[model samples]
Target chain A: MNRKLLLAPAAGLLLCCFGCQDTVNTVENEPQEPVSNIRDVRVVTDKFLRDRLIIRSVRMATAASGNQVAEVAATNARTGVFSQAWSGITGENPYTVAYKFVWMDEAGMAVETNLSAWRTVQIKPGETVFFKSVAPNARCRDFLLNLKESD
Target chain B: MKFRLLLLPAAALAALLSSCATDSHYVDATDTTVAVKNKNRMSSSDWVVITQDAGNALLASPLFEEYLEAYRIDAEAALKEAEAAGEKITTREKLTAMKPLLMLSTIQNNTSEHIDSKLLTERLREILFNSGKVRFTTYAAGEGQSIDAATAQARQLKNDPNIKKRTALKKGTVHAYDLSLAGVIIKQTAQDGRNNEMSYTFNLTLTDNSTGEGVWTYSKEIKRQHKQGALSW
Candidate 1:
C-alpha cells in the first residue's frame, strides 16, 4: 500500500510537469524572395537575457529616401523552454517586454534622433516578434537593440 | 524585565517597518519599467514615447521630404534674385528668409484631468525644429495683442537715433506662416471587474495655410491599466 501511494504521487507529479508545457504555434507565409543583407554580430554579455530574448535574424533594407532600415526577428526563449511557467504557478496572464533601438552613424556615434524610446510589447510562449526601425537620416549606418523585462 | 522585553520587540518592529518604506533615489526618466501612481493621467514617460514616435514618423514621411526639397530650390532661387537686385544679403539671411514658417494652432485637451498640452507640443516642436525641416512660431489666445505691442515698439525703435544704424528695426518685416500644426488629445476610461483601463489618443494634423488642406495627419494611442483598488478613482 505504501509503494502504491508513492507511485500515485510520482505519477501525479509527472503528469503535472507534462501538462504545464504549453508552447506557442505559428503559421506564416513563405516569402517569394529570400532575405539578403543580414549582418552577423557577437553577443558577449547577459547570457540569461539572451536565452529569454533570442534574436534570430536581422535584415537591412533601404527606405524611400535611401536611408537604412533594419528589421530584427526575435523570439521569447522562455516561452519555448519554460512554457507558461508563470501561468502554471498563478493564473492566465500575459508577459510583457520592453525594447528600444539606438541608431548609430558611420563614425560609431549615437544618432541624435527621437527614435530612441522604450516600447512595450506582450508576447506569448515561444512567439517570434519582428521589430523594425528606420534611420533618422542618411547618416545612420548601424543600430543597437536594447530589450528588458517590463513591469 | 518582561515589560522591558516587550518594549524591545516593539522597537524591533518599528525598525523593520521603517526599513520596508521606500527610499528616495534617482532613476532614469526614459525607463518605462518604473511603476506610476496614477494610471488614468498622462505621465512624462508617455509624452516621451508619443513624441518620439511622432517625430520618427514625420521624418520618414514622403511629404516632409518633398517639402524640404521644394524649400531648398526656392531658397536658392530667392538668393540669386536678391543678389541680382543689388540687395547686400548674407547666405544666412537668404536661407532664413526662405525657410517655411510653421504656426502652432490649438491643441484641445478632451480629458477629465487638467493637462497642459504644451508639454507635448514643446517636445514635438523641439524635435521638428532639430530635424532641420521646419520652423515654429508661437500662437496663443492673446498673441495678437503681443504682436501689436511689438510692432509699436519696433516703430519707436526705428526712429530712435540712439540705436545703431545696423541694428535699426525694419517695418513690415514680419514673416507670415505657410503651415499650421494642430492636434487633440482625447482620454477614455473603462472598468472591467477590479481593473480600470485608460486610453489616450493623440491626433495631430498639419495644414497648408494657402489651401487649408491637411498635408499630414498622424495619431498615436497609449493604453494603461491598473487594479481599481490600487489607485483611487
Candidate 2:
C-alpha cells in the first residue's frame, strides 16, 4: 500500500511537469536571398531576463541619409534541453521585458539623443519580437541595446 | 508595576512614530519602470517613451532623406558660388543656412482628462531639433501657443528712439518655415467589474509648407490597466 501511494504522487508530479512546461515551435521557408548579420558583444546584468529571452540575430543597414540602423530578433525561450512534447503544451505565463538602444558617435562616446528611452514589450513563452532603432544622425556609428525584466 | 507602566508608554510612543513615517526619494528621470499611482492618467515616463518613438520614426522616414538631399544640393551650390567670389564659408555655416526650418502646430487633446499638449509637442521639438537634422523657427503656425510674440515685441524696439537703428531687427528678414508638424491625442477607457483599462493613441504628421502635403505621419498606442481590490472603489 505504501509503495502504491509513493508511485501515485510520483506519477502526478511527472504529469504536472510535462503539462505545465510549455514551449514554442516555429517553422518557415528558407530565405531566397543572402543576408548579412553583425557580430555582437553583450554585457549581461539580469540573468532572469537572459534565461527567458535569446537574441537570435542582429542586422545592420545604412539609410539613404547616411544614418546607421539596427534590427534585433529575440525569442522567448529558456536555455534548456527538453522533449519535443514540450512544444505541444500551452500553459506558460508570458514575460515582459524592457529594452533601450544607446547610440555611440564615431569617437566612441555615447551620443546624447532622446531616442534612448526604455520601452517595454511582452512576449509569450514561445514567441519572437523584433526591436529596431535608427541613429540620431550619421555621426552615430555604434550602439548598445540594454534589456531588463519589467517590474 | 512602575516598570510595566513605563514600557506601556514607550511602546505607545513607538507606535505613534511608526504611524507617521514618511517615504520620499529621488529616482532617475529617464527610468520608465516606476509604478503608476493612477492608471487613468499618463505619467512623465509615458511622455518620454512616446516622444522617443515618434521622434525617431520621423527622423528615419524617407521624407527626411529628401529634406537632407535638398539641403546637400543647396549647400554645394552655395559653396561653389562663394569659391568663385573669393569668399570663405565654413561647412557649419552652409548647413545652418541651407537646413529646412520647421514650425510646431497645435496638438489637439481629445481625452476626458485635462492633458497639457505641451507634454508631447515640446518633447518632440527638443528631440528633432537636437538631432542636427532640422531647425525650428520662432514663427508659429495654426493655434500652437506661440512664444513668438516676444520676438515681435523686440522688433517693435525698432520704432523706439532709444534703440539704435542698426541694433533693431530688420522688417523683411524673418525666414518662413519650410515644414510644419501637427498631431492629435485620443483616449479610450473601459471597466469590467474589477479592472479599469485605458488606451491612448497619438497621431502626428509632418507637412511640407511649400507643397501643402504631408511628408510623414506616425501613430502609436499605449494601453494601461489597474485592478481594484475588495476595499477599493
Candidate 3:
C-alpha cells in the first residue's frame, strides 16, 4: 500500500511536468496571398530569443501625410510553457516582447522625435502579432526596429 | 589526483563568484532593452509609450492629412492669383496666413491617480509644432487660452508709456484660434479572485473653433494586471 501511494504521487508529478508544455495548432490558406515583404538585414545577438520568437515578414507603406509606416509580423514559437515561465532576470515571461522603431531621414541621419519610444506586445505560443508604427514626421523616410524580451 | 580535484572546486568557485557579481552602470534612458521594474503604475517608460502612440496617431490621422492638403491647395491658388494680378504678396506670407491656428484647452482627468496631463499635452504640442502644419495661438477669447499665460500680459504692456513706441506691439494684433484641442483621461479597475487589473483610456479631440465641431478624435487604452500568489487564490 505504501509503495502504491509513492507511485501515485510520482506519476502525478510526471504528468504535471509533461502536460504543462503548452502549444497551439494553426491553419491558414493553402495558397498564401502575395505580400510586399521587404528585404531586411538582421543582426541576431540573442540566439535563444530569436529562436523562440520567429519573425515572419516586414512591410512598409507611405501614408497620405507623407509619413512612412512599417509593420512587422512575428510569432512566438516557444513549445515549453512551464519550463520557460518566469525565466527572465526580472521574472518576466518569455511571451512578452518589447520593440521600438527608430526613424531616419533620407541622409541616413537618425530623426529624433517623441514617436520613437519603446512599446510592448504579448504573443501566445504559436500565435502571431503585428507591430505597426508611423514615422514621427514626413522627413523620416527610413527606419530601424529594435526588439528585446520584456516583461 | 588530489591537485586535479582541488582545481575543479576552485574553478567552480570562481564561476559562481563571477555569476553573483552584478555591475551597476548608467544606461540610455531611451534604450528599450532596459528591464522593467514595475508594471502596476505609470512609469517613465509608460509615458514614453503613451506619447509615442498618441503623437503618431494624431499626426497620421486622415483629418490632419486633409487639413494640410486644403491649406496647400489654397496657398498655391492664392499665390498664382496674386502673381497674375501683379500683387507683391510673397509665397511665405500666403503659407503663413493659411496655416491654421490652434489653441490648447482643458484636459479633464477622471482617474483616481494624480496624473499630470502635461506629460501628454506637452509632448503632443512639440510634435505638432515641429510638423509645421499648424500654428498655436497664445491667447483665445471667451474660451480658455493656451498654456502661455504671458501672452495677455505682454499685450497689456502696449499701454505702458515706458516702452519704446517702435518696439511696442500694436492693438488688435492677437489672432483668434481656428481650432482647439481637448482631452480626458479615464480609469477602470477590476478584481477577480487573486488577480487585479487596471485599465486607463485617453480620449482626445480637435474642435474647429468656427464651426464648434470636432474635426478629429482619437483614443488609446492601456491595461495592466497582476496575479497574487497561488496560496492567495
Find the candidate with the highest lDDT and give its number.
Answer: 2
lDDT against the true structure, each candidate = 0.72, 0.77, 0.75
TM-score of 3: 0.76
Inter-residue clash pairs, candidate 2: none
Provide TM-scores for the models: 0.78, 0.81, 0.76
Full ranking by TM-score = 2, 1, 3
| Candidate 2 lDDT tens digits, A24-117 | 6778678674433777888888786676688877888887767888989898885232422343342235666888899999999998666887
Q: Over 4 Å off in model 1, which ranges?
A: A1-24, A32-36, A65-67, A80-82, A86-93, B1-23, B35-37, B74-90, B96-99, B138-156, B159-162, B230-233
True contacts kept of each: 0.38, 0.52, 0.57
Tens digits of per-residue lDDT for model 1, B82-147 = 789998786556657555677777788788877777666667667667655677665222111112
Q: Per-residue lDDT of A38-151 in model 1, one digit per residue for the tens?
A: 666755466755776777778887765556778888876665323565555654335577878888888999976556777777776678888877777677888888777665
The candidate, 1 or 2, that scores higher on DockQ is 2
lDDT of 3 at B192: 91
What interface RMSD, in Å and to 1 decimal, does model 3 have? 2.0
> Per-residue lDDT for B1-233 in model 2, tens only?
99999999999999999999997888766667763535678788778788888977877788767866775687579778987999866566565766778888878888877787777777777777777767888766656445667767878998899999999986765667877888888998999989889888999988878788887889999888888897975
